[model samples]
Every structure is written in structure tokens, then in C-alpha cells.
Target: MTTESLAEPTMRVRPGWTVAVVLANVGVFAAWFGPIQVLLAKQSEALAPDNKEFVFGLVTGIGAAVSVVAAPIWGAVSDRTTSRFGRRMPWTLGGALGAAAGLLVLSGAQGVALMLVGWCLVQLFGNAVLAAQTATVPDRVPVEQRGVVGGWVAVAQVPGALVGTALATVFGGIAVGYIACAIFVVLSVLPYVARAQDARLVVAPAFVLRDFLRGFWISPRRYPDFGWAWLTRFLFNVGNSIGLLYLFYYLQDEVGVPDAGTSVLVLTAIYSVCTLVTAIAFGAWSDRLGRRKIFVVASGLVMAVAAVVLAFWPTWPGAVLGAIVLGIGFGVYLSVDFALITEVLPNAVDRAKDLGVINIANSLPQVIAPVIAAPIVKHLGGYPVLYLLSAVITALAGVLVGKVRSVK
Candidate 1:
């Protein structure tokens, strides 16, 4: 609660700054879906086609568990940091470097234990960078611009996925792809770190351990809007992860694509276009209309329908259509939902810490979704039933978002 806690919002977000953020986000996500997840899927396939989903779930689920703890802890540390180099930048630099090291380790890993160790490091350091970077949005951007900024973040992710997949395709070697991802992350993040300004925090009474612990516990009863938003985010992210985490294998196993790589790229291309358009358009429109909840609700419903399509069709065409629909819904939701979360944050002084707490909603789902889906995909009717479950959960997320009283 010192004067040190407040960040001076930027007067206007420069185009260059926006582009840096976009590229950084792209590189980060590319590292994720591009190399890490794809590598896991390939390894699982190598081990056993029948056990691919289970193996992937086990690896990714374990890694994501680290993120559930790492993200918030990183954010809390950033919130208290009084570094002249600025609070977020130090973490940003350290995280990117740490994650890159982890990726290198992963590239050379010869055994499951080594791979697990590397991936866990990647999740830990990667989420540290992510928590700090995302906190900058609320720290810098004005309310009116947040939706558009969120759109840019979402749009960056679309190409990040496409480009990451493209890199993997072109490299065709696991080590090469991992190296490329590492390079992209470091290069993409530098411009922002060097050029952007972060408010220097001045501590009055020195940091306290007790205060830090207390900060983590934001009472749901006191901040119902934040609670509701968090719940909605958790549900929606879980739904989304279940659909995506097994997509590579789904193409190979379910749709029977001989070489799933080209098909995945094609599907990602379609998804990219749909996502880019909806993120920009819907994001700006929501800003103009002064509405967020409706867009969020609609997005969840759209995702539900898309999941239903995949469940029923289970073909290349159905997968393509589902990707397109999922992209559209995901785009709009990504654009507006973060803005809503920032609006509902219970405290300004702990913005990064609080956002990190909200980020748990995101990270926890990544862990939970795979764990949940592994069982369902194994015991139930395979990928189709998984998609159906996604549909049900996603639709329920829409209803959950409607319960938030603040930030209409």
C-alpha cells in the first residue's frame, strides 16, 4: 500500500511498443504450441499410438502443474520488486533466458525423465515471463485501449501458432525446431525491454513476507466480480485446452491423415485467418459499444458449437470447420475477457499479483484439462466424446460469465 505500488499508465501506446508486444507474445506462444507440445505429441506417437493421448496428458499435465504455482509467485515477486531496471523487465529477461535454457535441454533429452525435467523448467520459466509480460497491459494501457490491445495480443498468437507450426514443418528435426523457438523468444522480447518505460517503485516501509502472503488471498466474498470472472476464465480455458492439446494426434488417429503435419498447418492457417479477423473487429467493436460480458458469453457459446461440430463430423472437413469456428470464438473471447478481468481486479497496488492470481485460472485449466481429458479419452468413446465434453463445459462457461456484475 505504499506509493511505490502504483504504475503510471502510458498516455498512448506507441505502434512500435504494440508491435514489440505482439512479436514477443507470438514468439512465446510459438515456443509453446510450435515446439514443446508438438514435440511431446511426436514422442508420444513414437512410444505408442494407442497411448498417445495418455502420454501427452501425463507430460503436459505435469508441466502445467508447475505453471499453476510459478505464474502467481512470479507475479507477486514482480509486484514487490523495486529494481531500477524496473519490476517486470528483470523477470522478463530472466524468464526468457531460463526458458531458452530449458528448451535447449529438451532438444538434447534422450529419456522420458530428462524430457520431463526440461519441460517442467520450460513451464516454470515460461510462465514467469508470461505473468510479467501480461501484467504490463494493465500497467501501461488505458481502459479504452485495453480491448484493442487485447485483440493485438490475441492476433499475435494466431500467427504465432501458424509460424511456429510452419517452423516445425520446415525444420523437420526436433532439436532444430527447439533452437529456432528459443531464438525467436529472445529476439522478439528485446525491443520492449530496451525501449519501454516502467515506473520505478519506491518502498516506504520495506517489503514484508506476511503482507505478501495476505495479498494472495483475495476474498471471493469481497470481490464477487473478480471471483466470477476467475471462475468463467477457468472453465473456458479448460474447455479450450481439451480441444487443442490432443489435436495433432486427433488428426493422425481420428481423421486418419497419413502425415498430420501438413494438415495441422492447413488447419492452423484457417484458424489464423478467422482469429485475426474476429480479434481485431470484435475487439474494436466491443470497445466502441462499451460492452464486454455479452461478447464473452457469445464467444463461449460459439466455441461450444464448434466443439459439437468436431464431435459429430470427425473428418478433415469437420476439423477445418471446427478450427475456423473455434478461432472466431477464441479471438473475441481473448480480446475482451482480459479487459474485463482488469476491470474487476480488487486492488490496484497488487495488479501484477492479482492478474497472476487470475492467471492461475488460465494455468490451472491447462493442468486440469489434460488430466480430465486423459481419463475421458481413454475410457469413453475417444476424441469424439472428449469434444462433446468440451461443448458442454464451454456452454456452461458462457453462463458463468453472465454472473459477473461489474464491467458490462
Candidate 2:
């Protein structure tokens, strides 16, 4: 069916379609987070033991910078696509393949330059897949069901991270771990691409360079809800990124964990289980109650509490408790907030592009987090100060959610 028939997205998506989307996301997140959680740190340490933190931050920050540009451009391109297969399908398939190629490059990298190159490729293409997938929720799912569907999709993140970390840990070497992630990403995305009934753009929109450029600048004055939603998401992610970016080091340096990698896996497992439970349950509850703002506010506050726990306690038990609390908070926030954002999109014609712009909120934090975190860990009151800052930012994100007047 063409997009003209799906202008309002009233039809409820089938369970099979939901499952496919979830699996594809699982793969994408696995490939992305595996390196973030384990492989990259290990590689950086090997390349520059004394300066692993700097190298890790640089590589990830630059990679996130690439994603900042790639997602919206790819989304806009997909918005104008007129492929026989579908608008989103071609890009989704191409992105997964390109990301896999990037992973292959990473698997063989011997120097920092090559490593940087490989990671940038992964981010560039990975965002394409993410952009297309994110848009599909609004394109296909009905409003009433979005919370539950978004919850299911949101829950994929934890499992994906877990799977990736486990693979990286089980595989041992960096090359083997990267290769495993590459294979998993390709395999996971295939089912979605093969089965998806994406909207086909029969006639491409008229391309006006000036108009196209203007489209990117969504005026906050015209769309206050979108602007507020964007800002809140950005703040929450900033807090999250700062909290997580230095976890490997935190475990080793502060907690004094002997085997940091395995500890990360364990914490992730606890976090995953909690997230899986809350994401689906809270999402369904939001849908049932037809309220989005309350859940978002509550979750953000909960996350802030979790960060505070880690800030003060600084023990293995503290990390575990923090993970559980953070997972619950994140699960609820991720699913419900996604539903809220979809409700606030400025225009349906540019769903993918708008989501991509919103995604900048997600990626930009990664870029800035390193800049923010490195100094705090190095100079300030160390991890304690970092966590306190995270708490403050996260709590503010929750307070700001009340400004998104459109959804609730």
C-alpha cells in the first residue's frame, strides 16, 4: 500500500511486524553498544594504555559527531525516495550492510586513525538504519497503540547491549568480537527488511535547495511542543551519557573491580531485566491511561535517584542497585517519551526527518559527554561529582517535561 493510504496511521500493526522491528533494533543496538561497552575500551587500552580514556572519548565523540550529520540527511533522502521496494526499505538494508562493512574495517584496524575511520563509517550508516526504523512507528502504528509498541522497541536496547557485551566478552579478541557483532547486525536486520510494508513515495517531492535547508530549521515558535520535547530528551540523554561513558574506568579505578568487563556484563544483565519489565508494563499502562507526561516525569526523577546512589555509595553493590534503578527509570522514559515525541512531530510528511532531528538530541550528548566527563573525572571531585551532575541534569529534564503541552 502507498503512503497516501497511511496518512493517519489508524490501523494497528500486527505482532509479527512488531517482532521484526524489535529484532532489527536489537541487532543495530548490539553492533553499536558492543563496541561502546567493551571492544573500544580494550582496543584503546592496547593502543595507548596510559591515555586510553582520552583515546576512547576521542573515537566515540568523533563517531557520534558523524551520526549527528548522517541521520537527518539520510532521513531526508529516504523521505524523498521513490524506490520500487519502498522509501525506508532501501535505506534500511543499505545502512545495515554499510555498518557491517564498517565493523569489518574496525576488526582489522591497527592504528588510531584506522580505528577512527572505521567507527565514523559505522555511525554514518548505523544512523540510517536507526532513522528509518524510528520513523516506522509513526508511519504504521496507531496512536493508541504506540506506547506499547514503543515500549517493546525501547526494550530492545538493553538486550542488544547485553548480547553485544556477551559476544565481545566470549569472543575474547577485538577482531573476533567485532566480526561477531557485524554478523549479528546483518542477520538481525534481514527479517525486518524482508517483511516490511513500507510506504512507497510514488513521486519524489520537488527538490529546492533553499526550501530543503529551511526544512531543517524547525521553529520553536511555531512548534513549542516539539521544541520542549527535544530539549527534555537532550537533557536526559546528556545525563545518561555522562553517567555511562566512563563506566569501564569507574569500575576499575573507583570500585576496584578485578575483572571490569565481566562486571559490566553482570550490571548490564541486571539493568536489562529491570528495563524489560518496566518498559513494557509502563508503556502499556501509559497507553491504557492515555497519559505520557506523568510517566516521563516520574522516570526521570527515578533515574536521578539512581545516579545519586552511585555518586555517594561507590561500591559494587551501589553499582548494582544503581543499574536496577536506572534501568527501570530508563525503560519507562524511553518508551513513553518516544510515544510523546511522535505525538509532537511538527509534520507528518517529514516524520523520518523530524525524528532524525530529534535524534540529534541522542547523539549530540555523546559528543558533549566526553568533553564534560573527562574534565570532571580528571580534575573535579571525581566520579562523585560526575554522578551528582548527572542527577541535577536528569532531574531538570523531568521538570522540563511538563512544558511539552501537546501530549499527556
C-alpha local distance difference test of each model = 0.82, 0.91
For candidate 1, write residues 1-408 as lDDT tens digits. Answer: 335337446476888888877777787777777754467677666665767667678778888889888878898888777788777888887888888888888788776777778788888888777877788888878888988986786567678888778777778877787788778778877987887577767662356789777878889999999999999999998898888878887888889998787788889989988988898898899999989999999999999999999999999889999999999998888888888888898766778789889988887888888877777777778888999989989989988898998788
Those runs of model 1 whose alpha carbons end farther than 4 Å from true positions after fitting are 1-10, 47-50
User: How does candidate 1 fare on TM-score?
Assistant: 0.95
* Residue 248 CA displacement from its true place in model 1, Å: 1.1
Q: Estimate TM-scores for all models.
A: 0.95, 0.98
Model 1, poorest ten-residue lDDT window? 1-10
lDDT string, candidate 2, 4-32, tens digits: 62397888999999999999888889989
Cα lDDT of candidate 2 equals 0.91
Model 2 segments more than 4 A misplaced: 1-6
